[model samples]
Target: MTDDIDPDEELMLAAEYALGLLAPEEAAAFEQLMARDADFREEYEAWAENLADLTDDIAPVTPPPALLNQIRAAAFGTAAVAAPQPEEVEPPATAPVFETATAQGRGLLQRLGLLPAVGGGLLAALVALWVIDATIGPSLALPTATATLVSEDESLVVEIAYTDDGEWLEFNRRTGRAPEGQDLQLWLINGDRAPISLGVLPAAQTGQLRVPEDYRQLLHGGNCAISVEPLGGSPTGAPTGEVVAIAPIVWET
Candidate 1:
């Protein structure tokens, strides 16, 4: 593809390359183009950064031995051989003087009747601290809300949750289908404020939307609406098409 590609197409290509969905030949061609075009390279790097951030929370895992061997064989034309086990070795014996000193120290504490008290106090303090921590510590939780948008005989379920990063909305269920050459757009309607566009819904029955931080507060006890708009989205910064569904956001306790 030429460097003067459409923005959406360029973004899609960058996403595909970052996700490793591109074929080897396509990846090679993309890499060549990226090397030649600074802007293309920047776009690809941005996609890579975003992909990395999205997956940063996932824990790393080691492959099973059988799977690893199969991968090795596929890549190198030979299965990986297991390394020989190392022989167990005995640890060095402790010096008698160190043991004697430790025993003397323990005997001195016990004779003074302080060892038991100290140990018990330390254990109790640790347990109390643990209890306090468990009871009062801030938990990693998000505030969530749900709403059901209904119009006539059709109904759709939507959920909103506030996270540290931003607010997210999930279309758990959608009943209406957008007409051909048109798309369904989700809008956030705060009390008397102008409707804020979330984004276009995918064709699937369920999808997610990220609400910008500035618009997150609007989702609390507000209303969510769906409207039919152009393929891309509403062009007039407002819904021009017919509103299909409207639901009140119910905050979760």
Candidate 2:
């Protein structure tokens, strides 16, 4: 419905359909067309929002006939009596157009820091993070608290400090295990309160765990515990297998 569009193209389809200017046949064609085209769909998201938003701000004020006549004359030819065509704006520039189902696929790649390339070409994507970070300064450090780790049936306890950021823990692994898939996972328990995930562990003679930030709050409130978990970590966010070594991280200074 826009200028130079022939009252036919898909972009005009969305523009007119969005404005309630499309006939039933044209509206049906637009919906079916949207199912196959990603770029068109992206454009629709941008355009539809604008049309929908105007509903609340503007009221239904009927203008005088002279004003209405002038407006109609300006928009449509004098002989053509139909909805005035609204021009379309450029679509929102989003990541490559993929179905929402692909959102999870996109996230998986992002977790390993791989998504920047697919959206824009490699160089453009690589600069996105740097550009984004430039506008925002360094991450702020969280408040700190102290806790303790202790062994049962023995008196090996260590007091530790944790911050809202996270706690880094190191512990010894028994020597002499062949590489048959032995791995270490870390978990944080706040008494009856639900536990949150701290990531998987790296294997060395001694290993370090970055405990969750919430641990400080839990420990300060008197409910903190830790356990080594299965290789790929707990299947559920909550621990499932035996909790190996446990400690209450307590703050002192």
Candidate 3:
């Protein structure tokens, strides 16, 4: 609600509201905010319009009678009963002229391809582009690097990727678990350079390391290694246990 909120977070909140995913109390509060804030109202309207266009291509489906009856019974403690059909009524003779004019206008628009030009596909693409810009921003075009760390016998394998934020490592352990009393520590090693401790891997076998600016230069074209350490990690600055896996970092344009 404050102007200091992150723009991306604000946009996402607006999108969630437009999707009708907010609870009743939250929706009421958002509506009240929108009423007082013109910019917030505009953001909500844009999201609503884009979402409506994105889902417009989906066909409506009718639920089975049994399902409908069950829902009705749960809500009202009884199933709905059918009522007598209403008698058919005739329309005024002028209805044909209005119907013909409407058909003619639709035919003209079809001939001009205006209707198809505004179809769901284009709207979907626009929505995707908007989301990408909002979340990843323009920095998504930056280059990245990757590598695969493997043990001496090639039994243990871990995938590593480097981006602007930092390096990410993923292991494919059979159990994806660290030793009962030990932790797995990651290291970055360059020729003759002291092994730099990157951090310990999570029990889930996937973790990220934010390379400090001072150490970023040493990470490129370096060797990545993992070693088993004490529960809290290596007490000494250097690795004390045997190196488990090593891989060469490869940069990609």
Worst 10 residues of 1 by lDDT: 100-109
What lDDT is obtained when candidate 1 is compared to the true structure? Answer: 0.53
Instruction: List where candidate 1 sits over 4 angstroms from the true fold.
Output: 1-142, 155-166
* lDDT, candidate 2, 110-178, per-residue tens: 322321112122224224322332223223344344333332322223333455445564544433221
Query: TM-score of every model?
Result: 0.41, 0.31, 0.40
Provide C-alpha RMSD values for all models, in order: 26.3, 24.3, 25.1
Error of 2 at 208 (Å): 5.3
In model 3, which range of ten residues has the least summed lDDT? 100-109
Error of 3 at 218 (Å): 1.3
Ranking by lDDT: 1, 3, 2
Tens digit of per-residue lDDT, candidate 1, span 78-178: 21234322231322233122211111111111222221111232234323422332233123354345555544343333333334345567775545577
Global fold similarity of model 2 (TM-score):
0.31
Model 3 lDDT tens row, 96-189: 2221111111111122222112223223432342233223212335445455555434445566677644544434443334568998787876
